[model samples]
Target: MAGDKAVSTVSKPVMRGLLNSSIKRNLTVALTLAAISGVAFKQLVGNERKRKYAEFYRNYDAEKEFEEMRKKGLFQSC
Candidate 1:
């Protein structure tokens, strides 16, 4: 009975250590993934803003072209 008790005590600490190690590893992976996702999201937002700016300038130039057309009497104004 005494030998069994000693073995059980030793096993308990070993089990606890294993559990702690597993938890630490999982937390490290989660933090790494979160950082990677944040960086990717920032890049996507930057690219989207650049595309929108380009589109806005294209539309603005088209309007200027129309004004020039009006000046040239390409179509009669209402």
Candidate 2:
């Protein structure tokens, strides 16, 4: 197809430039960017999960629950 040929021709120069350039440096930059973005994405997700857990536990009554468990004889006297 003419369109396919045109697209390939357009891309050839770009690909050729990448191949002719400092490939190691380009790869390093790309890898560094990927690592940074990955870390940022992980941190974002982790922070969101932490916030959700914190919000969920904000109204939790740990002492009351423990007392109830003790009253139920769930734990031995220590």
lDDT of each: 0.84, 0.84
Question: Of the candidates shown, which would achieve the greatest lDDT relative to the real structure?
Answer: 2
Instruction: Write down the RMSD of all candidates, one decimal each.
Output: 7.6, 8.8
TM-score of each: 0.43, 0.47
Tens digit of lDDT per residue, candidate 1, span 1-78? Answer: 768866744344566579889989999999999999998987999788988999988778777788889888899652
Local accuracy of candidate 2 as per-residue lDDT tens digits, 9-77: 334446556765778888899999999999998799988999999997998899998999998999988
The lDDT of model 1 is: 0.84
Which regions of candidate 1 are displaced past 4 Å?
1-14, 50-78
Residue pairs clashing in model 2 are none
How close to the true structure is residue 61 of candidate 1, measured as C-alpha lDDT?
76
Query: Which candidate has the top score in TM-score?
Result: 2
Output the worst ten-in-a-row residue range by lDDT, candidate 2: 8-17
